[model samples]
Structure formats: C-alpha cells, structure tokens
Target: MPRPSEARPSGARPSAQVRRFTPAERWVHRATAALMGVCLVTAGCLYLPPLAELVGRRRLVVTVHEWAGLALPVPVLLGLASRAFRADLRVLNRFGPHDGVWLRSALRRRGPRPAGKFNAGQKLWAAWLTGAVLVMLGTGLLMWFTRLAPLLWRTGATFVHDWLALALGVVLAGHIGKALGDPEARRGMRTGFVGRWWADSAHPLWRPGD
Candidate 1:
C-alpha cells in the first residue's frame, strides 16, 4: 500500500480549512441578531395598524421593543473582551487604498471584488448599522423619558427614530439577501471554518494566522 502522503498526485495541494469566526464572535453575532429581530418585530406591531390590531397588546409590544433596542449594544460590548473579535473590529474599521477601488468597482458593477477579509460593502454596512442603532437608542430614550428633553427635542427624536427604523428594515433586508446568495460565506459563519480555496479566491488578502 502507498504511504498517505505519497498517494496524492504529483504537485497537488492538500485541501485545508481555515478558521473564520471564533466562538466568541459567532455568539456575539447571534445574540445581537436575536435582539434586533425582537426589536424589528415589536416595532412593526407597534407601528403598523394591521399588526397592532392583530397583536392586540400595544403596551406589551412597546415594552418589548424598548427593551430589545436597549439591549442591542450588549453583545458588541461583550465581544470586545475577545481578542479575535477585537482584531476583526480593527480590520473592519481601517480602510486601505484597495477599499476605494473595491467601492468604485462595487458601484460600477465591474472588475474584481475586494480580497480583504471583510469587503468594503460589509465594512460600510457594519459601520452604518452601528450608528443607526446608537441613534435609535438615543432617540428611544428621549421618547421614553419625556423629562429628558423639551417637547421640541422629543418631537424631533420621534421623527428621526421612526424614519430610521424604516431605513433599518430596508438595509437589513438587503443584508440578508446578500448573505443568502453567498453559500460559502454563510457556511463560514455557520461552522466557523472555511475552505482555504475559498479564502484564496474570495479573500486573497486574508491570512488565517493574521
């Protein structure tokens, strides 16, 4: 019988898997997603007359929405304790020369996609979502505790809070659609490991050891 190493074809590369999301990172992602889902569902119930009538618990919905939105930052805050999560956050925050090219290509719908661990679009989406959530929380607090601000401030908060919530729904839908379209990317998130081949092709700039 041939030795295991000798059995491979000449010049063939071994199939390897790379770590993608750490357990800490995945847990944070899932926890945040669950809370956001609760917030969105409860917001729909509170805002949509049809849903409000069907649900028939206006006060309960309001309570749930408020609590869920308030808890949105908890997972991200906890995630900062993990070294891997912190490293990924740094990667997401920094935009290199290639990122501009990636954004332009993305907008033009031509040329090669980004080869970074997180693409430009993903970075922008993450940043936008973070800001939107913080703004929503601030506005929500103003609306919840009327004494926090004057009537004019409270009114403006309500307007911003409501419209921003609508915008979040749309952006989140697009995010989900993109995720659903990428099986390998989804697999990485689901299993925490991805093929080296995928890493090379989709994220050539990403090094597993990095």
Candidate 2:
C-alpha cells in the first residue's frame, strides 16, 4: 500500500472508474423522480384556485396525483436499501476542504462547478430532499390510513405533510433549475453518464476507492 506521500497526484488521470449505477438503478431513480415531480407539479397546480378551474378533469387529476404520490417513493426507497445507493450517498455526503473553496470561488464565477462526481451543494440537496420525502411520506400515510395517530394529530400531520411538500417543492425547483441552466448536468441524468470534464470539475472531492 502506498503512503500519503506516494499517493497519486490530484490532477493525474485516474484508472478507469466503472460506471457505477446499473440499468435498474437508473430506471428506478428516473422513474421515481419523474413521478414525484409530476405529482408535485400537478398537485401544486391543482391546489391553486385558477389551476383547479383550468384542469379539465378534476377527479382524474386527483386520482393521478394520488397514484403518483404513492409510486414516487418506491424507487427511492429501493435505492436507499441497496448498497450501491448507500455508497452513492456516502460520496455525495463527503465534504472536502476543497468544497468550501470551490463554493466561494464559484460565487465569483470561478468555482469548480464540475469538480467531482458530486459537489457539496448537490450532496446536500440529495440528502435533504430524500429526508423530506421520507417525512412527507410518513405523514401522508397517517393521513391516508386515518388511524395511525390520534384524530387531532392526524389533522396536524396533514398540515405538516403539506408544509414539507411545499418546502421540498422549492428545493426540487431549485435543483431542476440548476440542472436546466447547465445542459451538461441535464444530460448527466438523462444519459446516465456525465462528461469526463464535468465529473472532474464539479466533484473534485469524489474519486475511486472512496
């Protein structure tokens, strides 16, 4: 084993890192995220008075909304349970000394946007969003089943669920907004393989043997 002094240089080309996510993992993430997004958008629109009027079929909209909400977490939960997903979680959660520097520099348009496999912001986003989903799901279930908690608490849970949903929606919007602003990022998830430069620049803290 090599000592720290003998370790590979930071900028040196690394040995080939295998494509991490398998097709099933990709499918699960995409499907769940897509469904969750649709559920949020549709439900949010419907919640607004004007959108309720604009919707052609109220019952159909509600049905689809409910179904999508239920389905959205399946893949995410599955991913969380798998080792690959857990490993991904670790990489995303890893905060490096460079992350802060990159963040500060990026504020001035000099930050490492494509530094590693994931960056500090993206990791934090993933962690919080997933946690928010879990909370919302729990509250949603209590409301749906109508007997998990006290009647009063069940009502309160509804309020909590809606509030968290709204908060999560804001974060989700920001996440997607950032992705859309950079076509490379949008392509990463779409193609399930981001460019070499993107990984190098965006996620400098991420490397193999992590």
Candidate 3:
C-alpha cells in the first residue's frame, strides 16, 4: 500500500494553512475596534445637539467618551508583550521600495501588487490612525482637565479635537468599507489564518520562507 502522503493527489499538501495575524494581533485589533466604536458613538452624542438632548445625560456620555479614548491604546500596549506582535510592529514601521510601486498599481486598478504582511495602504492607514489617536488623546485630556492649561489653549484644543474627531469618523468608515469588501482580508483577522492561495496572490512576499 502507498504511504498516506503518497496516496494524496499530486501537489496537495497535508497542511495548506498560512498563518497571518497572530492571536495577540487579533485580540489587539478587536479590543481597539470595540473601544473606538464606543468613543465614536459617545462623541456623536456630545457633538450633535439633537443627539445630546435625546441622550439627556451629558455627564455620563462625556465620562464614557473620555475613558474610552484613554483605553484605546490598552490593547496595543498589552499586545506588545508578545514577541510576534513586536516583530510585526517592526515590519509595519518600515516601508520598502515595492511599497511605492504597489501604491501606484493599486490606484490604477492594475495587477496584483506583491506585499508582505501589510501592503503600503495598510501601513499608511496604521501610521495615520496612530498619530490621530495620539492627537485626540492629548487634546481630549486638555479639554477634560480644564485648569491644566490657559483658557485660550483649552479652546484651541477643543477646536482641534472636534474637527479631528470628524475626520477620524470618515477615515474609519472607509477602513470598514475596505475590510468588508475583502473577505479574504477579513478572514485573516477573524481566524488568524488565510488560505495559501489567497496569501500567494494578495501578499506574495508574506508567503512561507519569504
């Protein structure tokens, strides 16, 4: 009788799964998403007068928004405890020569642009989101603490915070739209594994041994 491996169809491997995001990465992503949603919803309540009146509990809403914004970095900080997460951070921070080519091709709706764990667009989003969060948090703290700064500074912070929040909301919608449109991309975050073929075509540079 033939061995089990030999009995299988030619070119069919016993293990076809490709590891994508690690458990730590997935957990951070989910936690951040949940907290971000809370922040956005509460911000909406505070920003819109009609919504604020309907909610009728300004103090409670403000408290929730403040805490949610503060907690946004908790998951990422905790995930950094994992070596894999740290390694992936290093990968995300550095952009290669291919990234520019990928961006151009993506904009033109051209052929597949080989990318590693994260393509250029994803890296850009990550960087922008990080900076935005930090800005929001700093300005939020300024607005909340009241006496920490002069009235003029506090007013400026509030103005910046309000406009940035609006921009963040739009960017977040686009992010969700992109994720929803790509089932394979969503699966990587949802299950921490991606089909080998999907990985090969979407992120060829991230393949095994690459």
Predicted model with the maximum TM-score: 1
Models sorted by TM-score, best on top: 1, 3, 2
Give the C-alpha lDDT of model 2.
Answer: 0.68
Query: CA lDDT, every prediction?
Result: 0.87, 0.68, 0.86
- Across 1-210, the per-residue lDDT of candidate 3 in tens digits comes to 532212334565536777888899999999999999999999999989999989978999989999999999999999989988898889889999889889989899876586988899999999999999999999999998998999999999999999999999999999998887777678889999866766666777885543
Off by over 4 Å in 1: 1-15
| Candidate 2: C-alpha RMSD after superposition | 7.4
Query: Which candidate has the highest lDDT of all?
Result: 1
Q: How close is each model in CA RMSD to the real structure?
A: 6.4, 7.4, 6.6
The better-scoring model by TM-score among 1 and 3 is: 1
Tens-digit lDDT track of model 2 for 79-112: 7767767777677778777667667776886534
lDDT of 1: 0.87
Q: Give the winner by TM-score: 2 or 3.
A: 3
Q: TM-score of each candidate?
A: 0.92, 0.74, 0.90
